[model samples]
Target: MFIRTESFSQYIRQYPVVSTLIALNVVIYLLSLLPFIGDPIRNFGVGSNYMIAQGEYWRLVTPMFLHAGIMHLLFNMFSLFIFGPELEKVAGKARFLTVYFLAGIFGDIATFFVYDSSYLHVGASGAIFGIFGAFGALVYYTKKMLPQLRQIILPIIVLSVVMTFIGPNINAAAHIAGLVVGFLIGLSIFHPKRIISWRKPKLKVVQKR
Candidate 1:
């Protein structure tokens, strides 16, 4: 189900929401590389508990699109790329966006409330974890029909959770918060009857005459 065989244009057409999100992330990351405005953008967008306490409320949402470095950007975007398209396909565009943004916002909120005022962070890890949570919910609701999905998804979720804690400089609170929020959102919106029929598209092989 996770393998992507679609051409680039086909993938974009089929999953506009995921494509756009990945594009936006890349654009924002590129903007942050500008010599003049780069630092300003990062300073303004980073999730800073102190700045948030001082009424920079936008920091919560902004950090979802900001990354600390190239590796950070690549890792989060890669996660989103791998996991996001399926959820977007299953959840539809509007619901998918709702899950993505809400999970990210709540994750940042958790960071703001749980961490010290001096704490600062920037990345899309929280939002990506939210996608993971949504997948967990999907497997939970549809496991009977797709019993094999549990075997596939469960290991990923567990490994992700373990890495969240053990990884140095990780934001465990945001990751956990995003995961919980995504799962809850998924439970509310996802129905087995609706998704049970959904299947990965089969790639047609061209025959040589």
Candidate 2:
């Protein structure tokens, strides 16, 4: 169930918010490639040790936007492009972005606290993982409406869990933490009842005298 297919876009115009995010990430990646700025930018990567240690805590949130390389950037952005629009369509732009940023922040914070020493870490994986979490919450909330999505839902969760164990350069722990935090946050903020209430606001009509 690749949401990037023509069928998904057939009825829904690409969410401007998500598209803009994708564009911004790409632009940032391009900016990081400039020679003068490239080295510093990659090291700073949304979170640099100096900045982080100096109590520029926002680095936790910012790091997720910076990718270490082209392949890293592409994979993260492509995953976001594929899964994000649909999640935004379901969850709305503001909420989706909130989860994205929060998840990234939490992921970095978790990694920072657990690791004894600092390492250069950057990428949208944390945020992308958040998107996956959001998708899980959305599917669970709308199980009655989206029962067909279970097959899609289960595999993603399973795959993510599996990837965490298949050790590599990937900060799978951060990804896991981000996903869990995002899922919990999404679940709390976007419960089934709240969604129904949000969707069905009482309309006020006024007649001109």
Candidate 3:
């Protein structure tokens, strides 16, 4: 009999950093299920307008990493997995992480300001939108090379718009805010680097022997 090995590790190596982030988010969510930690988890991300208004400003960012249920977490993670690797490869790990967190914060802050005292919200859509923003920026910047990206992205944007109107308990403000912030940050990353002139080396021809 022949032995066969199976491992997704090799496939994941191309995006080690993104994998790490996904792992961290999953771990944190799992931890939130414990009886002792469950309530505290709500404080971190329940989207309670009251808590947010009461000066728990940190909640805006925290909520992005925390989800309300298994389905919620899975959906967000699925989207992240689908889109994050490409964006991370383009933006680089550090910048990609920055954009994710900033977009999440933007979403949270927008929710905090827009929703009333009774409503509470939580999910990773904000960060996902940020990734979408970066994707749009990438398509725009590389229009010469990848004009097709715009066409692909346009349908997704339209679907998201329709979802905002039809989906119940959706936080439309946060989504818009995250998209704007992500786009701005994405655009900023493309600014031309300062040029540095290099001294030319002189070459001399040797006399034929």
lDDT of 2 by residue, 1-209 (tens): 55566554552466777777788889989988899987776665666555677787777877777887888889888888788877777778888888888888888887777654556578878888888887787777777887777678769878977887785788775798889877887797679678778879688999999
TM-score of 1: 0.90
TM of each candidate vs. truth = 0.90, 0.87, 0.82
Model 1 clashing residue pairs (backbone): none
User: Highest TM-score, which number?
Assistant: 1
Q: How would you encode candidate 1's per-residue C-alpha lDDT over 1-209 as one tens digit per residue?
A: 77888899998999999999899999999999999999998888999999999999999999999988899989998888878898898788888888899999999999998999999998888888888888889888878878787887889889999999899999999999999999998987786555555554668999999
lDDT winner, 1 or 3: 1
Model 3 residue 4 lDDT score:
17
Worst lDDT run of 10 residues, candidate 3, spans 191-200
| Residue 101 lDDT in candidate 2 | 85
Better of 1 and 2 by lDDT: 1
User: What is the per-residue lDDT of model 3 for residues 83-161, given as tens digits with 9 covering 90 to 100?
Assistant: 7887777677888988888998888888877878887888878888888887767666777777677777767766876
On the 0 to 100 scale, the lDDT of residue 127 in model 1 is: 86
**TM-score between candidate 3 and the true structure:** 0.82
